[model samples]
Target: MYAIHSVLAGLLAGSASMSALEVKSEVGRSGEDGIFQSKGIPSPATNDAATSANFKLLSGMADPNGASLDVLHDGRIPRSEDDPRSNFFFAGGSNGGRILVDLGKVIDVSSIATYSWHPGSRAAQKYQVYVADGSAEGFSAELKEDADPTKAGWEKLGEVDTSGEQPGQHAARLSPAKGKSLGKCRWVLFEVRKNPNAGPFNDTFFSEIDIIDAAGPELVRIERPKKVIRQFGSKHGNFRYTLDVSAAPDLEEWCAEHLIPVMDEWYPKIIEMLPVEGITAAESITFTLRNPADLPQNLRGVPAYASGNSVVFNADFMRRQQTGEAIGAGVHEVVHVVQFGGTREKSARQRGRANRPPSWVTEGVADYIRWFLYEPQSKGAEITRRNFDRANYDGSYRITANFFDWVIRNHEKDLMRKLNVATHDGYSDDLWKEWTGKTVQELNDGWKAYHKKKLGL
Candidate 1:
């Protein structure tokens, strides 16, 4: 997408070669964005982003468990990050998915600061903002967007769009008001669109959303990253992937018919991939099928997410899709379950946080297995004529899966499993060299060369 189209692009230009530093999102680093949808601010969004700023305490606002009383009025400006401890929010559905934020009590609101991010093609988000008075409950009741909002119970603001978007291995910032005050109310909603047309992923992420109390703003002194921060995403309890279908009986039926059986079948395979000990997951694993309306807007197009032994699926989304789709998706989610990596592991890595397994690799591991190991017949991970010129091993999903499969065959026999194990237990690209006697860039070079020769370019 960035226009690097020579026949042997990375090889000829050297600029396109993906180095260790070039890899964007790895595990413990991916990223969020908004609101009344849940009782609290979003952090620990399904994607791994966190923090509004890099201060020590209350640094990553909106990160899972990382909210701060001072985030809104602290007066400290937010700069984003790819750290798992970074702050952000997530909304789901298809396009126009949104988050509703309820300020529990009515406070005089003058300005709002909202920030969102994604590391790759998913970064550019188009969104419309709105605010409602305490008298309003939610968008649950339809009101006129064109009429007087106070009389109609809400006021809609102009749309905001992001630029300078690139593969997000790093983070990008989106301004809620762009430094101008938006006179406020008790409730605010951000209706977001990641894509105008359908492709694959389309959830909106919010890294920071604050209803500024600039008049009586709070100040938070800069601090270093600490345990207090990771705790925002710290996990407790055992691994479980339970399926809750109380809302949708049909989804329950489908899960019983497909998801459960396949997950049960793949459990051992994923377990076998993670060779680490002392990393036992929670005993319970749940896969909940939720009503799309009640679920967060971020979960909109997201078919499934694996967190703390639990995986949640967009029930209505799944219900409409085929049973075979759920079965293949089950393999990927279960890998996350087997990953069993958590905040504690992340905290340990923070001491030397340079090289966590990038999100692409972990995600690639999931697709690699789903396509190559589980169902090669599908050719699901094939690199096609259409996408080959721009494809990178870190491009993620099936592309990365195909790359992973190539490295496993040409370099090390156990590359995928070993890489998974290293990432789960705190290892990085150093392991890449350990297995192949080559650095990540070297491996990328070899992989690209293989493709170039195959294409006869």
Candidate 2:
């Protein structure tokens, strides 16, 4: 089993006097088990003032890759760490935005909590909170980029900066200090900011926000659909897998009848096919069938993709191609889950530079495993007379897969394994010659020539 890391910290600092507010934070937990289940800090609230409030983006643009502003108070959390549609973030190249939450009327605001989840820098939180009752002198519903909230009838409650090395589930709770009250307020503004020291895409993936009312009805938590999680393992107990069909329950029967069997047989084989020294493949993998509408617009048409130990499939595509290409596509993405399971930081440091493997090589290996080893009967990578001219070794996907198949059949039998390891340990074109006694270009040319003649093109 993989080791799980969890960290909790109490952060109590702000730009102004925080005598009335206290902050608590925690990070590094999985979504299926840990998120919104905090013990030391307040978990996200479903029946909060924000639930009935109207949210508007007052400043920066929303990232097209992330969910809209409504996601913040939707009373639902992401099912996975990297679920883009369940979180809202500012655009990559811009500064963070402001969110205005109008609670209809002033009530006693008791506490506020924010939740976020991601596997990288975007998991961190950095923002300031402000509240108002709209009766203060010079009160402005919206402030300019250079304007100060404290000068515009807004009470600067406190600031939160949970930036740290760990990347996982993170939550921040702000409540009144001992013997103090946050007082009454009707408008709450979040002045969010991107992490300056982090990468270009440092905008936080805000999953959900909660605003507790001091005197309100009993809390009614949001009810999520019961997850249909099927847990199974290899016969030898060497690997474990989970299949989740909660988002697309309609495909549950099809998955049981077809998808599960293929995964049970092929997942272990793919892991064994690509072995790297001093690196063990991920012992646990998750396969999730997601509604196409829940996916980012860019990924709605993609059959499936893998991230970390998770593989997400487009439910619409799976439904349309279940009896035809769906199983094969699942195999392809499973190959990626194994391919990217290991850490390359040590390898990059030893090589003195980070040499990313080319996309052609990456996609080629996945398709090679899918079309050649898993379902060769489909002949999915075949080069016909019509596409023979366009079939190049570096063409990616099926074309590159066909090239790899030819190389393995003609020159080296274990070429894919060697190439997989080489790419994991910092890839270079020179490694091709060392393994097959020919340059990459030579192999590309020979592959095309053989296919051209075979197709009589």
Candidate 3:
């Protein structure tokens, strides 16, 4: 009986050991800030190793032919069916592509895993991995059409040909196809070319790539991008755009230097303020600076206006940027482009109300975003002591903008966004009641009273 008890204990211990190993190999874990919790796992790159955690999509990630939508997010997971949109693409009917991923720092790389997908094609996945030390002899940290990554002193660590890989995306393990080990490198340059050995229909859809070492995995710290991306104005291409300066030749240089950056910075903010369906049409937004002499007197006084897909600015208004009066005009105009309420959606029930958000509300909304959100330090929306008596919230521009800011700070945190949706889809003052449980008039009166008390008026 004593010998039988000993045997049972030994069996139990072996089962527990097997379970721990399985968890370590299959579940690659990560934490809040770029820290891998792999803890000596055999496959450390299994978790978010290629996406947000262990690695970063650096400056040089591009296909000679542009890759598909949301490359970073799509490439975040290996064949993540959770989001149909999460697949990085290369142009259709192309052979294959290249992408540079930054590991944030130099480390010994023991293994890597490449994951990809295609709808129905059974093209074998043939690829090469080139390791770089993040020096002059490495792949560019900035994306450029003329970039030649091959000229750099990149060492071919290995090649992987998953010709036996099933019809579409399959799991490819991390073992060098050429060299012994990748040694220590900061960037992994992945190249996939059409194999002369395979038949036609060899296009590729890249999913994810992960690099790992024996010590385990560690996430490429996200905040570290500021060291490289900030100087290059990484926000520059947030929008795909085109410029039409045919009308205003004098404004060409200024538009390239100032206008483009401002639009890129603010367009994202406006998009975040709306629901997915509220996105602006896919048409490229044209920025047309009209010749000063041709400008109408009424429009001449205005800095810029959003007309269809175009944001037109008078040459005179472009010059006002020197005095900082029109520094945020692009922001204000693009806000109009993004605010598509009454036009995009209007049922008979909404149209019968025949109530549009007051012109003051729309203009006031623009100024509030410019003054309160974009450049608060400008104090552009301050209701000064001299104008205190006439400072009705309906006065528009700075006056109404001040009231809008108050509502955002005190009552409804997302007032501007809600107000925009309400006005765009058949506006009425009742929206104020729905948002704050008070009439617009009551909110105005309360705001004035608070200001009067604080200013000792």
Best by lDDT: 2
Candidate 2 TM-score versus the reference: 0.54
Q: Return the TM-score for each candidate structure.
A: 0.46, 0.54, 0.45
Number of the top-ranking candidate, with TM-score as the measure: 2
The list of candidate 2 runs beyond 4 A from truth reads 1-34, 57-68, 76-98, 105-108, 118-127, 136-138, 145-152, 156-168, 176-184, 192-205, 213-252, 261-320, 330-388, 392-457
Q: What is residue 53's positional error in candidate 2, in angstroms?
A: 3.3
Query: How does candidate 2 score on lDDT?
Result: 0.79
Off by over 4 Å in 1: 1-241, 341-355
Residue pairs in collision within model 2:
none
User: Where is model 3 more than 4 Å wrong at Cα?
Assistant: 1-238, 276-283, 341-353
lDDT of 2 by residue, 133-191 (tens): 78877889888877888788787776777675367777776666543346678888999
lDDT of 3: 0.56
Q: Clashes in candidate 3: how many?
A: 6
Per-candidate clash tally: 61, 0, 6
Model 3 alpha-carbon miss at residue 123, Å:
70
lDDT of 1 by residue, 1-457 (tens): 1211111011011111111111111111223211111111212211111122221221112334333323422323233322222333332332344455555444444444344445544444556555554454333323333333334445554445443334332222222222332343455555555544244543334344444443433533233222110001113332334556765665555666666666766676666666554465545566766655445546656777777676777666677666456667767887887775433333343333444578898899889889998878878887767778888878999889888888989888887768766775566667778888998888887888888888777
Q: Model 3: per-residue lDDT, tens digit, 11-77?
A: 0111111111100111121112121222222222333334543333333333444344345422344
